[model samples]
Target: MQKIAIIDYNMGNLHSVERAVSHAAAGNATVAITSDPDMILKADRVVFPGQGAARDCMRELETRGMAEVVREVIQTKPFLGICMGMQVLMQHSEENGGIECLGLYEGNVRYFGTVHQDIGVRLKIPQMGWNQVWQQMEHPLWKGIPDGARFYFVHSYYVEPQTPDLIAGSTEYGISYASAIARDNVFAIQAHPEKSADDGLKLLGNFVAWQP
Candidate 1:
């Protein structure tokens, strides 16, 4: 049986993610919500999900010594990062007054400040609703999910990957930005698939079946 570990560092909505993954797996895999580094490393797949402040999240991972474990796992397995999980993968963040991040990917996370569309209409920060995602490239996680599917988003910050090729998907709040990024075995999203309804479930299901 496949083992999927949802890393629990007290920074994310762990139970909700657990439930979503369970539902998506549908008796095909064993899912565990754990903070233990060994268990996370042992799993066939790893999911890093989080919400809240980036500084607090980084501190928790360091405090629990899961940082190295996460670094190792992402290199070895089919890994998925959600929201803050994706932000932390970048080299730095403009959040928390500019903090350093995991540096796994060449990018920076920036706060969405005073967004204005082409028509000069102001959009709210923390984009707390469904937004359309345009697939930038073909990826396994995009399997069965439509080209312009809407996903649930609840964040004031977004990732800016150094290379355009790393972007798997893009979305516009006031401007277009990388909503999803993937390279090798790692795929991360700035939105919450757990809360994205049908399209989200399809993404999670794709991840469960991904060989990657």
Candidate 2:
């Protein structure tokens, strides 16, 4: 049986993610929530779930000495990143007074500040709530999920992948930003599939069966 590890760095919603992934696995694989680099390395797949500020996330990752382990996992295994987990994979972030990130791909995380697509109709920051995700490219993780599926989102910053072609999905808030990115064995999203109901569960299930 396959072993899947959810890298833990004291982020919020780790249990929800764990439960959702467990249900998704359907007894097909074993799942573990761990900070131990050896276990992560030993697992067949890894899920990087995060919440809260970028600075805090990075601090915890570095403090726990798991940043390099995360860096190593993404390149070698089927990796899934959620929310702030997705943000830190970029080159830099405009959050927490400008923080440096993992730079797994060429991108930067930017905050939504006074963005208005319509006149005088301001959208809230942290964009808390459900939003529709438009799939940008075809991939196994998106299998059985509609092209424009709505997912749960709660965040103030979004990612901007330098390579446009790498964007797997996008969502329109005050503006349209890369909500999901995919490359090789890595797939990351800004939405929390655990709270997304049916579509969200489907995504988790797909990830378990995803070969790439």
Candidate 3:
């Protein structure tokens, strides 16, 4: 049984992630609502879920002393980041007055700009709705999942991985964005698989059964 850890650093949507993992039937899993580095270091897999500003997330991560632990997790274990969780993995975020991030990936989180509002109705900034992601790469985490699958998404800023190969899937808002990413032991999805229906469950299940 893989010991999956759903990191809880006072971000958003922790319980739903846990429920989704349970729905995937992972034999061994725990939701670490604490900031303990040892728990994360010991876990076989880690899921970083967030629903807020990139800067705030970074602040909390640092406040809880999980920043270094997160960096260490990406260095060793299989990691998955959801929404803003995906944003923080990058080098920096241009949110809440520009903040530095974990730098696990080379890109930064930026606003969609003039074409989109920071927050509001109709093509909103937060992007609070369901969107489809087209699979772009072949990886174990996406195993058995077909292309053009709809996943729940809610964010103002989206990710743009440094290279094309790191992109596992993509979704379009005012523009097409990197909806998912994978590199080595790091795996991240801009969409909330926990709320994405059957395809989402399959994706989570694949993660549970994934090796390397």
Candidate 4:
């Protein structure tokens, strides 16, 4: 059986993610929420999920010595990053008054301001609701999901991948931003599949069965 490890650096909603992955797996795989680098490396797949501020997240990751572990795992396994997990994959973030990130992907995370000049409308900082995610490129994880499916989003910052081709999904809040990215064996999204219901579960199921 395949072993999937959800990296628990004390920065994510681990239990909710575990339950969601479990439901999605349907007994096809074993999921473990672990902080040990060795155990994470041993897993066939890794899920990196995070919540809270970027500075604090980075602090915890560095302090726990999980940063290098994440870098190593992403290069070799089928990896998935969620929400803040997706944010930190970039080189830097404008969050927490600007902080450096993992630099795994060439990009930066920017804040969605209180207003969008292009749309000429006042917008909320934290876009906390279901938003339409448009598929930008073909990938295995998007298998059964529709082109313009809605996913649960609760984030103020969005990623801007340096390489446009890496963007697998896009969503518009003030402006359309890269909401999901995929390259090689890495796939990350700036939404919560755990709270996204049917389509979310389908995506998670696809990940469980995905070979890349």
After TM-score superposition, the amount by which residue 24's alpha carbon in candidate 4 deviates from its true location, in angstroms, is 0.6
Q: How many backbone clashes does candidate 2 have?
A: 0
List, residue by residue over 153-179, the lDDT tens digit for candidate 2.
999888999999989999988678899
Lowest-scoring 10 consecutive residues by lDDT in candidate 2?
114-123
**TM-score between model 4 and native:** 0.97
**Would you list the clashing residue pairs of candidate 1?**
none
Tens digits of per-residue lDDT for model 4, 10-36: 997899999999999999999999999
TM values, all candidates: 0.96, 0.96, 0.91, 0.97
**Residue 45 in candidate 3 has what lDDT?**
85
Predicted structure 4: lDDT: 0.93
lDDT of 1 by residue, 1-212 (tens): 99999999998789999999999999999999999998998999999999999899899989999889999999999999999999999999988898899999998998777345334767688799999999999999999899989999999999999999999999987789999999999999999999999999999999999998
Error of 3 at 190 (Å): 0.7
* lDDT by candidate, in order shown: 0.93, 0.92, 0.81, 0.93
Q: How many clashing pairs in candidate 3? A: 1
The number of residue pairs in model 1 that clash at the backbone is 0
User: Candidate 3, residues 15-48: lDDT per residue as tens digits?
Assistant: 8888898778555554444456787789888888
How many clashes show up per model? 0, 0, 1, 0
Between prediction 2 and prediction 3, the one with superior lDDT is 2
